[model samples]
Target: MARIPTAELSRYLFAGQIGHRGCLRASRIRIAPTSSSLQTRQFASHVESQAPTATTVPPTPLRKQLKEQAKALKASGQKKKKKVDNQTVPGWELTVGIEIHAQLNTARKLFSPAANSFNDDPNSHVALFDVAMPGSQPVFQPETLIPAVRAALALNCEIQRVSRFDRKHYFHWDQPSGYQITQYYEPFAKDGKLELLARDGIAAEDGESITVGIKQVQMEQDTAKTTAQPGEVQWLDFNRVGVPLIEIITLPEIHHPATAAAFVRKVQVMLNAVDACVSGMEAGGLRADVNVSVRRTDDKCGTLGTRTEIKNLSSFKAVEDAIIAERDRQIAVLESGGVVEGETRGWAIGSTETRRLRGKEGEVDYRYMPDPDLGPVVIDLPLVQYLASSSGLAPDAETDQLIEDYGLTAKDAISLMALDDGARVQYFYNVLDALEQKLGSASVDTIAVDRGLSTLAANWCLHELGKLTELSNNLGMTHKGECKVPSADLAALLYHLHRKEITAKVAKELLWAIFRGEISQGGVTEAIEANDLWFHELSEKEYSDLADQVVEGEDKVLGEFLRFAEGKGKAYPQGKLMFLVGKVMRAGPEQRMDPASVERVVRARIDEVYIPGLKSKE
Candidate 1:
């Protein structure tokens, strides 16, 4: 048989299955006849006669391939060729860095007795030390150091034994101290890395991992918050003045905005796992400052373009959008043969854009100095180890175990854990253990516990407890330790539902009444009995009576049902069947038969009366 040219083979493959035009024109290439020796000989002779002779010098590897392909196409000149764009946009690359601020889970401020809580009255949580009064001395809280150390360890960083706090001086209405205490010369932790997984897009891998290096994780105090001014002066809230915070600085190693957003989300999950920070992006508990730069493929990391710092990006969406905008801005500048200026910029969340805050020349020095009053923080290694090993396994690990052990999807496990801010996971496990003992099971696993307990906990906590807490907060209700609806009662209510002593609807109503303080322990069962909320057990006679009413009362619905039974209907009688069941139940209001039983009875009666010949179908 005639040898197929390699170029022809590649063209066959490419044209057959590659591009849009290639795929469309693929049917034109016919397989050479291989049946008879005579046919093969003729084909071979024809191919050789058309082939080039040795007098023409052979082409180079790349040139030979191109020439062969061009010759093949020349033979088929009647075919129209599509043009492809090979024009490259020169000097375009994205560089990214991250500045993460994690709110320390501390009881007090880094240098004051001010309570580190959000949503408190303005300035109510502030102390004299927070205001930086002349005589006020800076005293570091031990609780503050623990979480900072924990965060550093979680990031896989080496914690410094002797890290000093410096004065990051800047003039702002919120800063009563005139300077913020932070680590500059010597940071608390260094040399850590994080892995992020992109969620979507063509460039995105469903779980494609990217690792970013952590330059430092330093302990700092948060500045006071400023409320936007409508008329004149911006209202300053000093309550957050001295709140302890950890700043996780990442190297400018990221190349894509999507990857950076993914990294931030993973970090947020990690923080929540360790209970180091609340993942409240809007409330400023976990905030990010994106540092973006651009360069060519050949440019060195730092030599690319000037890095622009996008400040106080609160959400993952904001981080990704701001980085994209910044990347495009830098790319545009570079394409125009202009240099991008190094500056700090503020992201407008509403418009999803960035505006320059200050140029490099206008940068604050933030004079560095150690706090004279506060001494060195000496970390006890044993205590650190104990905290890591015994405090409880990370939530991520538990979530993974739940998925593997229970055959649950990752989304389900994540959803279950995220319910009630992660309290549901713990409560589900606890309740499951109690239930297993009650049921006399020998060591039930996480999967069984998840499947068995997830629904109950979700309803009780997410729906019931959430509603109660929200109502209490809204009404400014105070609990004197004797308020209605204790945790045990909530557990008992779930238990009752599991035992089939109460229906799901009745349980919800009971929970609401209990939460509202309308039902107390003395009237618990009485309230249920008075409301006639118990799950009713239907007798055979009652079931038969309801079935008869459903068959006789609605002639149109009965006709549709008969058609479905006789296999003469194009569509199922679902709506009419439901209406028939409803009519039957409406006739006997005191009969509390569930919709399931009603459907079962109606279907059975329809089959017996209308489809006696269809008995073999079932």
Candidate 2:
């Protein structure tokens, strides 16, 4: 070891403190000065020193200050600008378009026979063609195309007679091939419209309907999925590669963020109804890319402003929120005299701002060319016609049919269709089917179907079973075969209630008991008998006697009723009258007593006894 000079050692220590990266600057470092140092305090300073004084103006009186503040507030109130609608920005127009990639529910991939799945072991479902192996040719499967056509029909799109595929040239780690196969130049379907009404769960603030135009729906192959940490080794799953995907493009007609969300929801319902897609968004079955632009709302605004793309919004809420955040960002930029640059942006989870991902890619950047391997997809007129008529009903049509045929209200019908992704609606129909089978006919003569059985089923399915699903951690009721109670049991319970064999209250009690496993027997009738829940009709005279006893015992309520009836009281004793009815029902066999009959008897007794007494007093 060598002894270093004092100044050289000091310099080395300083350099070590502020590393070569210059993370810490010398000016930021602080050092205490000693008497021997250049920056030192004066020696022998006195304990007491005279302080310099400055002149000050008098403070304003509190009252006068308050008066000035009040005047300022009044002036501000008078000059306050008009408030804009919160649903939309003032002096600016927002336009949005959505590009959704929905996976087709087919057994095989779009170009190979590998099973189309997402949950299988990584790379287990990949085919040789998926990996782009040497001499492996792409075999187009018709199974994938059928569902695409079905979805197009459900969305009211005109099927193209001849659609061709093109290769989108791009190099990525996940994409083994040098290009992606998509229907870029000629899509399969075009010019469709989706009607969104107030009852469709997505409506304007004024409850007006919006018709969103569909630009095109094209069939394409999905790229392989990649999952990795930042600056780490990437894990690639080729199972998603060559999977069937239908790219649904909408015209930039949407103006509101919430409306954009509603559009995605409506499309999900339609796809599910047609069995074209079964996996929900949580499972990566569908994803949306939002394109948004904001322009000044003035006469000078003729052309649209620059648009930016927000990619891979997985949830509906994310879609709406991302649009709002990006719209506001663009508006702020334009208001600040800054040009809105077109770029690809990404929304961080739980953030209210969009971050730039990259500059927007131009079509020329893709270098798209006609796919040399795959031929043109030609659709026959007969097949299209058959699918148009034979496919499952669209969500709107299904809702309408439910409202009409089953005599259900618009609210209840839409709710049934919306619950658990339409699984509860199927449960409702299953109950109806079970009831019809038990009653032996679908005619009005059947006691079950005659008395709005479908409406009854809908009510129970939503209120009762929906609550059960919520209490059970939402594990049941959304998916078929996961309901807390079987549909057959529900049908049986509804039968008893409708036939007057059991009261509604008893029906609810028995339903919970069944769900909680408190019932010893499996059948609803057996459980009702075991729980002593059967309904019994009371005669008119028996009801009158019970009411007379109740009225005689409730003298306080009787006096109140009399005073009110004779105009000597302030408010009517209607609630007290119902209280009396409750006492009468309790005085008798409450479970067996009909509440409506008891009420009628109680009201009659009150009128018969109190009204006459009041008349005599008058």
Candidate 3:
């Protein structure tokens, strides 16, 4: 050959190494001379020799070889085995753990007396210690410890009598101090557990509960918020610089995305119950950092693959979707013959995939050292004992109480608690109490079940009143946590509706009238009678006459009745009979008759008239 092109020579060398193992085996490859130069010829001769064959075939190109290898590998065993439990992809098992940073709701910062508040003017709440002034000293506040202990107790954590803070060293624009003050060596609380109930819709298995392990709950100081602008200008908000936080680290026990989301929700409910921290995530009160990883079915149970941390998930939905998207991403990486590096990642708003933020930092990288300024935190024994016994009831306990006391189903109890921080649940009890007092009964079971009041009250409070925006605002804690409709007033409406004195249609309209000042306290009965909203008692003769008028006016409905009476009925014709019943109710003023009574009367009239007409024709 006169001259060989560089591209073609490289292609031959690449394709010559392709082997049955689906990879390039460079040691077994042998090259042939493409140029007559002595240097090239000598190099070619030094390569391993191939045995002679009767017939030779041309080598396949590298691109085609790679595609064939990938396809063959996938078809052979890449997807042959499936995971037994909690499989997001067919052959892969996903693992997830979360780090929740919740800002404590306190009047002052953790170490300093600076006011702990948000959305105020920037720099207004900062103390000299918060800004890391040279001579400023840190003073530990006893008030901050109250909420932290309460939060730990709510999570069923074992509180450490002696815990100390350490300095986590890192250089960032937001941290005015050279280091971050946190608890790394010895945290405040450890070995906590949270149970995800099946009825809450986040259980890993259907109709079963999952218990997630909490590794530690450490107290830390939050860093200042940093906003980066164009041209390298950095803006810092120091309002959040020294806000108190509890870093709740969970063990790698969660597997499914829904379970992770549910776990966070349960934490929020717990914190709220104890008045520990600000539970809302949108206001930067709570944030989640999720660590996600994946492995194949053959791997050992404890042998977890490389994991990536997705940071600053602001909402429960974001926490759920981010884990799902990140887990799928890792599986795809391993399937393509690539290794997933440990890294920190960020999920941009509205984006499904996570982007790399930085390499994962280790403890050595953080250079953790005990803070010289702060001493070991001491907990009072009496206070701890008091909290253990008197901590606010969690949502689970409340759910159980609601079920046993009110005879409400688990679903109904959960729905009531979901409404605005359990305020609706409080209102629900108020209505029941008011009804009990009015009916002169002390037994919840008797009051709720004997008169059908439990289901009736739940329907009005959650289904009807909960749906109206104006009513929800005005009636739901608008007056210092008091219902505007006055639980007693709504109870009166339920009382009348239960006794069949007014139809449900009248009850709803009268409820709105109450909200508009048209109905006042003790005026439910007066208003119903005055407006003719009450159902009037009618004799059998009057009902029959009314039904006859409705049946004669609707010719088409009468025809269907005739068909049914003549034994040519295709179906039960119940709907057609109900239509005529509706006509009879409309014939009365305000349609005050009960629907069941209307249907009964209409059925009798069709039997008396339509059936007789069919007999005459026969």
Candidate 4:
């Protein structure tokens, strides 16, 4: 394998003019003939003379022979395989690069004081400077710099003490400023590497490690969003304008599409673990542009082929599809005697194809000069170190501690923390601490925060609370912010369930009602009582009487139960047994009797009446 520059290969791959002849040129091989052919012929003739009257056949051409051999090899399997003549088929390699843009969780925009929020109203968050109005001057927000530095530190990047912003000029409807204020020449952070682990395939040590070299991580302002409608003019929303954006440029080290997707997912997870990004693919909070190129394996990987940039791959599936389609397109072009052109491509998700967007352009020659209106971003080393230390706690470390301290499996801990944002995780930690205090010191020793509280909170929030929020959103009953079911209420519900005051099922119902705003005060118990919802608990005599009545009312089911208890029936029919249980439960106020207990009681009565020799457990 030869080393190839990602840029050169990307250009050719995107150009799409590489021809089949060029590919064949790289696969050409040399061959020589020897006198062994005559000797072999003479020996075959002597052997024929000594045996039967058969003539030896002449040898076939090497290409034809190889083709036949290849066909035979393929025929031994389930499907037909294409013939690859080493002399004519080119061996290709893929090199992948990525540029990731993460939105900073800052309160204000990079150059403006407008709120950095995903507001519904368009252009409401834009300032004069964000729109590049005449006489508008850029004033850097000192607050945005800390999060940027924290993000760099999280990625293990070296932070540059002094970084400057440059104007990247581009013309687009969403770019109302006519130029993007970005870091081009002097970035705040540089030279980091990410180790990516493969999600699938055999665990081969050689292929497991994928090192992504980070060229730079710079802070920039996000462009406004554009909403398009057919036959109507596109609408621009400048709400995202001046929003702090971090652009991370990676060296072209990825070689596979699936690998690229996995890398992106890992990066997303890492960013989300901290509060750097929201990691919402659908909302475009984090976006990626994939740079892909191909080359022959034997040729120097640096003998650059055409490269193409797949812009704004929002989802992991889209990233994988774009890479595959681009690779196939490049191969098809090369096999057809054409050259791949250097260009940018847009992934048409509907068609599952890549279409040419524009010719490739180098880093914009905005003649980048430091803005005269903005001063150099100076980082106080002590402040940076303090912020880094106070950056709460990493989810990974918290998750590990939860696993160790809470007597939970690492897998369970990871699952619990998987989708939680840093704020949510901290909130959960506080909830768990409160739970520990309430339960006393003995409970703390026996119950891990993860297993006792965090795990329950994770399930309740992800399943119950999430379901309620989704339902409320769908019904337009409440905005996400207003659908407030506090963690404390959830903890209270769990505590009630833990104390056996209410069952898990009843607690879920209470939670649903509370989230629906049915509860006005107190907790779930008060809500349940106020709603006149009560769980019926039958005494021993009541249950005995109900069992007797059920036996008398349902002779057929009773017979079946007797047979099942005697081991005479074909099987314990789940459908028939459940039907009987339902009939009995519905017959009286004990309608909510636990299904398992009902089954056990029915089975015990059947054993006592029909199988006197065997115990109920038997």
Candidate 5:
């Protein structure tokens, strides 16, 4: 809670009724109706009243004088503090828009023959044309357009039949040429929408929807990397200079920071679905610049305050924290009788506040002009429709279908979809299919194949076998073909676990044996027999006698139970009964007593033997 020093406040000078310090006049400062938390003070009015007359003289500069007055005015009124994590910022409205640069999934650069890989040796992948010599011209890569269409279709963007490229000029160490090539006037896609399926960690209730908007998805070239050490001079690596990127621009439809984070996650998931991009924000494959602006709670969009753009957020956590920080920061500035200015800012991953990268008077013109060399690219309709059809096999569509076809809960279906690689995801569904087929022939109730086996398959894949198996992605291998565990063995293992023929723990042991190739595929019965992993379930008559023996033999539990039945002691009798049942369970490891049955039989024996004996004695 450090106060802004009087001297430090001088840098916030802006135009209007306020023109630095000497320009303060008799104009009134009006803020909108305040919430109870901010307790908005009429500090500007107070300062106006305390202004010097025309005849009066002061030695200090106008900027310094205004800063001192502004500092003193903010301290006069105190307000109630609101929780940082609170859902609503009562007096203010937040608007956020994200711009993402997703690296395209291609072998070479967008306009050059350079290889597009992040891990290559510095400048090793750069072509001579990437350095942009005087006579060089740009050539378009046809293969890169496929993933771009996939992204646009997944986001529900309207595909523009013809889009042209423009030259964007900027002076930076990262740019090889004097300017970069991008889609400025005519982007290939526009007018897309994404309706979020969740709200604040909860599934969207029936008939509740929040849709963030996409303004455009433009293909552009990435810049180079500038490597700088603490004391050494900076060095530029042109390896990534002309790498292709799909820039997805969104309208300012986001209010909550969590909503913003979830939106980014959804985009990343979709990008992965099409193999469009690696989309690893941490590794710079995908990154975002977030624009945040605030207005009064009742204010209309036209009157919204100036925005601050936080640039190059590397991860989703960074995106969330940066938005929250900028939101509260703007509120504090406005509450302190200062105007929020539009500026470019940088946010490090773990930083508490954003740092000003550069100041902005308004928008900086990139001087965009159509590229003379490259032609206006026309998107083929059939190609786009094919991508849309191919995306049906993606996780989003597949997850919903799994829920409908198998009657699995939405949570279970999503868990199955979160399994990363395509092969692993396919393996899960295939095993579920195999188990359903096996159960349909062997069981009386065919419905168990759909409901019971689906749940069992998802559970074992996520919990028991999933935790033990390693995916190709985890090993940093890009190939997504085959996984370690065979689907047949997994199906058989879940079958035994579902039937209570083996404990879940025992099932895990058997799965690992098959994973190590110690047991062959479709060898669940052989593995159980060889390893004594088979478990037994007690019949009703046998469990009844066992429960009777447990009550008779455990005298300590009986004393505790009898006193509790008479209401003479303050202990729970069920705990003692469960403890006695656990002892019987340990004695017969071969027979894995269903815990629900043990508890039921134990309670019945207690009611029949202990309570009735007391009544007979009385």
Candidate 6:
């Protein structure tokens, strides 16, 4: 909350920062549209992901030992959680501040005309300005500010009417400009806070709360990348130089690794929701650095513990793992009567422990000064509102409204917003709006939850469409532009589903078909007519015969029903009934068949055939 002068702030960033980029950025930023910000991974189905593929090295014995220790510490922390988290780890209290660097989603670099692309040939996208060539002067990229403002608003920060930029001097191969330009003093936004609605890696129980302080949101240029392999010369790639990055620095309010990791994931999600970044941490478009320190449980206001900064965690899991490992390591040092040293450490992807990168220095290490090359950034309230309105960002306070309106849980809305995939969220609501136009407002509400429309849409995007895109190796559902399925097509498909013109299966098939280009423009009707992928009503006689054929054909369900009829088997029947019902519908003559009709026929046939036959036998 306290503002340091430009010079002092510059010094502070340099002193506390890791070499090259103030910190080595993490591996990737994965953005998912879900209930909680980055609470769930849209990329991986689950929250836990293995380290990025690039850093999957074999762990040394020491690494294994450290990992085991981390597990032990984490388990102990879980056990100790009763009242205060400060006492959760037992014998030591761990506190953390997370720094997330989200690479802005843009076509051009922050201060260069070069294209900002992932997976292109290395250095091919680099401009002369990127490498800081003598004659190449840095230029402002207007595109960067939109996402930055969106992010600040999402974090509940006050936008500075005018923000200044300063340069922090540091030397590294990746930093071609010996002094890196940053907002060490005046950032675009400051003094904000966000509540991570998670406790222990899942949604906090209903009626629970946790808040992390937002120190500032600084719009800075990402440093160049360096590839170092032991025993070989290090490679410097300026391809990443001058890439626009937003640094979300949090207050040291997180007391546990799970909470810290959740907050980072939340930021990743929010960044995506605001259309600020693509949110793929594995791709290095986003990454996190965690600062960890341990203190005595009784030393509430005592001097802070010696902080060890972990640099470049590739994934959320890695962040948690590194925190746990470092937490235990620091606690052990103190328990053994040794002082915890302040240093910068790097997380080895395959290992359980952190490697000491360098001794942590003070701000004096990087002398801060105003950059003569770049002028101040003037951000007005209108600009902030325009960005927020254009991006369709939901207010951070509207979690409850989102849940009630969409029939989603608080976590679900938070996940959706956190990924900052506002477009997807808007598209989903537009589907609801389309349904409301037909089914009425109340009808739409019933459909979203009771009928599973909300879950269905999320699944179709997460699993089915995700699979299709992944197979094609596209960016998947995260990026609105790159996703193969048009929002209109998805909405139309859902509309057909709501009207009961198509079963869920039929709807999915239609979506895939359309996305695969098997069907061209137009809505559900056109898609259905084009591909013969509709579900229609079956005649009573035809449906009955189909149901009879399925029951007789599948002995498993037939036997189970007979056993169930005799009251020998318990009540829940898993497959036979639905399986028979599905078989009748799919094998029906009508391309567009009514599924409810199939269920009705299947039940009627069971009563006429199975019940009478069983009674006669008795």
In order, how many clashes per candidate? 1, 0, 0, 33, 3, 38
**TM-scores, one per candidate:** 0.66, 0.73, 0.71, 0.68, 0.71, 0.68
The best candidate in terms of lDDT: 2
Write the residue-wise lDDT of candidate 3 on 102-152 in tens digits: 999799999898888776654456676776765897888888988999999
TM value for model 2:
0.73
What tens digits encode model 4's per-residue C-alpha lDDT throughout 305-335? 7788999987766777687778778878987
Predicted structure 5: lDDT: 0.70
RMSD of 3: 19.6
In the range 1-618, model 1's lDDT, one tens digit per residue, is 566465543332222112234334332221122222331343334333333222323323433454575676578664322211111224566778898998877778888776786765454565667765557788888888777777777777887777777777776546665677888768878899876533211124224666789999998888877654323223345567788889999998777666777677667666766778744464478899988887787766647577888889977767877877677777778778898888888875533247889975332465567766666667767767766775466655776776666545565566556543354555555545555665566775642765656455545544565566654533221121123455445556666677666776687778888777788754656776787777775876787776785566455556676677667998887887787777777776533666667778877777676445334444
lDDT of prediction 4: 0.64
**How well does model 6 score by local distance difference test?**
0.67
| Candidate 3 segments exceeding 4 Å error | 1-87, 118-124, 204-207, 225-237, 282-284, 300-302, 348-351, 392-394, 443-446, 470-489, 492-618
RMSD in angstroms, all models?
Answer: 27.0, 17.5, 19.6, 21.4, 16.8, 11.4
Deviation of model 1 at 592, angstroms? 2.4
Higher-ranked by lDDT: 1 or 5: 5
Cα displacement (Å) at residue 414, model 2:
1.8
For residues 456-545, write the lDDT of model 6, one tens digit per residue: 565554456555654464534444432456656776787677667777778767777777777666565775777666656566777777
Q: Model 5, 65: alpha-carbon shift in Å?
A: 45
Best by TM-score: 2
